[model samples]
Target: MTTTPDAGLRQDRHLATEIPGPLSQALMARKDTAVARGVGTTMPVFAARAAGGVVEDVDGNVLIDLGSGIAVTTVGASAPRVVEAVEQQVREFTHTCFMVTPYEGYVAVAEQLNRLTPGTHEKRSVLFNSGAEAVENAVKIARAATGRSAVVAFDHAYHGRTNLTMALTAKAKPYKHGFGPFAPEVYRAPLSYPFRDGPDVDGGAAARRAIEVIEKQVGPENLAALVIEPIQGEGGFIVPAAGFLPALQEWCRDNGVVFIADEVQTGFARTGAMFASEHEGLVPDLLVSAKGIADGLPLAAVTGRAEIMDAAHAGGLGGTYGGNPLACAAALATIETITADGMIERAREIEALALARLERLRDADPRIGDVRGRGAMLAVELVDPATGAPDAELARSVAAAAHAQGVIVLVCGTYGNVLRFLPPLAISDAQLEDAFDVLAATFTELS
Candidate 1:
């Protein structure tokens, strides 16, 4: 398929050699010494160039990308608009530091965020370097606005790797293992895990259960905010029951607690809706966004009601490089791409294509205990057929097989049994079908 010259890589998947051929292996050896041990890669193949739906590795293998750099590159690895914008911005100026000199790109980005984020109410935005930073700032604004200390995150939540966000996150091994004494005043509540929690509890019931926990453990009067992902990301592509988010939001409003929607992974048309929060009309008090916002640039933002966002003092809210001009230009262009390119509908089309395949697999294979998610962001939970217990080994085997066959997939969950698929909206129907063919074969082989 033809693509822009800037996005020079092809859209097709072609394995020129073994998965991680000698060149990649040599690079891996170098990376072992040069990079920190804490950083880990899902696929061993080193990328030489990437564009559209495929990533070309150092060994010349063009592998179909299903993970999309952990839901970052929604438009494509090298989308034309994003590339053009960044190229133009770099030629003009890379960074003057918005805090010191100020610029149009940063203000334009903030304006876009305020306008595009859910809710028609007057909103304000602040930029940051990462999702964790956006979330930290959101919490700060919440506390400043409400004069409260405690914030509640849900079970199976994956916030970020920072000190405060580590306390906010639910998983402990990799993200929070040795990082204690974590930031204080952070609490965890239960999430509406439909597959595991069983059939009896619907969204409302699950919300009440969580509310009860919040009320008992950390009272409403003491709470600053209740942060959540409408569709949980690293906690598995967990889509909570229909009314759960609204229920929690209403409670937050009544209790004078800020409702923060951490849309780091679910925003910017990743789900069928522009924001996953829109699925149920969840107009959060504050929305922390990153990942897909800048088409792979290091950018994040917290958009919220004007009053709450303005609570923080002028000197209290910014960093030297929070809103780099290049990143802002990328964000503006990415937003334009999403709107002009009909990416929201593309995400729905992907949902229709992938969900049907996954549902059929679930129906045929007992090991596929659950297949759930929204739009391009989808996942399947692997479980033991006999006992219905989580089969993390099976998940790993399936992922490894997919990787060996030149398809990129990622495994995540509290139990580590969920295989999440987040293909770029730019992915072709043929490439997606081919990836699924490989996945089907891998599952059958493992079975």
Candidate 2:
């Protein structure tokens, strides 16, 4: 319940002018010239400072932050503990390269990953700079251990944007449109999207169908890994049906394929659980983590069974800035805050508030085809009411409308019809209510 000092500004939404007011519009011009065209932004307003649940823009507009920078700032951007840790670490030696000289902070983070990641088995961890790197390393470990080449990913899965990860990812438009030729040997299986798959196709049936596809398309013996997000992230916050994860884990166990849980988005209590796998009692052989790991700093990890992680020969894994001292320090403080500051319980509370509000919204709107996901990682899928077709335009309109009113929202899904809500765990209930009010108003205005 600790709040960061607001520096004489209140922690409530306050719009001094229209969003992206004069100053922000000027910055946007500069960004257009300096930044890459491929890079996209959700809000045009450049953030000057952020604390708790609000981000103050360059134009002095206080906007309610619902996206959390794509769920990276779970502890809130500029969290006191994380900032303090980073400052202290920077004063100390910043980097000696963990692979070359080594440091305690790196080992400490690896130890934390080993302990925090699911499974009581002997675990080892390797640090990476991003979720994509962690996923690629997980695949490497699986292949090295099993000596198999083919990897199985789900239909709506989003692993990362790296060459191998892009191959594992399902969406092709933005993530993989012109980025080919992608890496080979990655296969996609049917995911249990209950909303789209009809009522009869439950978790067990979905698992069977996916397994059948794997058997036919990529032989079980040839598969090195079965990578999945226990609660899917960018491919819309699609939470697979119950028993789907457990069944997949069992299949991976029965076959030689390693079960890798890509908890990049769902990790660190974003999904109302310590890890999304715990919801179904799944024990993935490899667990990938990032995003909320370091409270916005670049840090990712692959924690898995010791034997599998050690399958690679000496010096086979690692990067120059894999576990930078500052990032490690930030991660340690972030984890401590999550555990000691009751953020996990806060996540469950957030889930309750968000679902209650969103379910009400869905009840009133026919265009809302589905309201799904868990904890703070909730999303609403927009669809044409009459024909039941995905309505990407409606989704975009609602998000843009919300953004214009000083509430930052983000859109996702393969069809671009999902409006994801990833409020920070540290966000107050009042802030949440205010954001949802804006959301409701947007829907009312558009519908």
Candidate 3:
């Protein structure tokens, strides 16, 4: 069941010092020396503890958590059931490596994923350690099943950082720059980006456009999979136009191309449904999931038609640490909590609250070009009022100002001009409104 935040944890923001504070500053100095330059941090403060909707820094400062660690802690960071399950699993055993000895937890998690992922046809699931790994495995399974090479991705897509996924990803900076020599046979197509693509271009037209590009560029017969985020995450939480996903799925079905839904960030009730594909009544040939699967533990899965999933040879699809027992245990409990604790309804409540607050902010502020997303995952794109050009600098400034005031915020998008909000579903309404108060003030001051 869902438990309240720790008694000692206050559901309010408390600034003991400017953002990083003294302890966090000292820790930053040590981090600078010890951590790699490639690693990045959004909030400078080091978190000592986090519960419900608040994160406590080492300096005794309390900050409202709006980012949810990039949408990982949906059930909340210290979910009681998840913690208890992890502790019990640790006491029993940490790892037997599912590939080595196999375990019930692994099978149980696979069973849960199979039942939860979209589609009622005979299904199968394989667990991995991260979103990227699950995505890579999906691609592998598609290619194996279809005996095709080329894969099609879309614009404004952020799959992951691994080489194969990097090639599949569209952005060039940070995620792809200097990481060339990427995997081959990965092709790109246009997405139904409504804000920029204009309102006249409906989902059907957009799907035709994308399909035409794929046909002209990469023949459908040559394609093994067409992977996409149902509601693009990291790519600024861009929700595709209505009918767009359904049309694409239809095309994939006719063309014999495996349609893969990369629900890594949009799955597990984050989008007010078990999976975002359900929003369009679309059932993908393969669905990759992670992030909120195990609350905070590392676990991911690729669930799809049994025949397709079994395409890979007996030993072709597993890592040494894939589906570790602890992660599996945590995932089972996380799923149970989401089902029993009414987290899905909670997500819808969060969406209503966030959208109402954000709409009011957008109505008053000309810089907010658009406000779009589903359920708990939402974002506002910043743009110049007069020229309609992206205002990434203003976005950064607003995020920094919010950080100073003890509200954790995140910035994303291809142009780095989108401010995304992903509060935990377990966070109280009071805590959510308090965070927006800071956000509204930040926008007022910065704009």
| Residue 91 miss distance in model 2 (angstroms) | 0.3
For candidate 2, the TM-score is: 0.98
Cα lDDT of model 2 by residue, 131-183, tens digit: 99999999999999999999999988898999999999999888999989999
The estimated TM-scores of all candidates read 0.98, 0.98, 0.99
Which is the winner by TM-score between candidate 1 and candidate 3? 3
**How many residue pairs collide in each prediction?**
0, 0, 0
The best candidate in terms of TM-score? 3
**Native-vs-model 2 lDDT?**
0.92
* Residue ranges of candidate 3 with Cα displaced over 4 Å: none
lDDT of 2 at 220: 90
- What RMSD does each model have against the real structure? 1.3, 1.1, 0.8
Which residue pairs does candidate 3 place in steric collision?
none
Instruction: For model 3, give the 10-residue run with minimal summed lDDT.
Output: 1-10
TM-score of 1: 0.98
lDDT for 406 in candidate 1 is 92
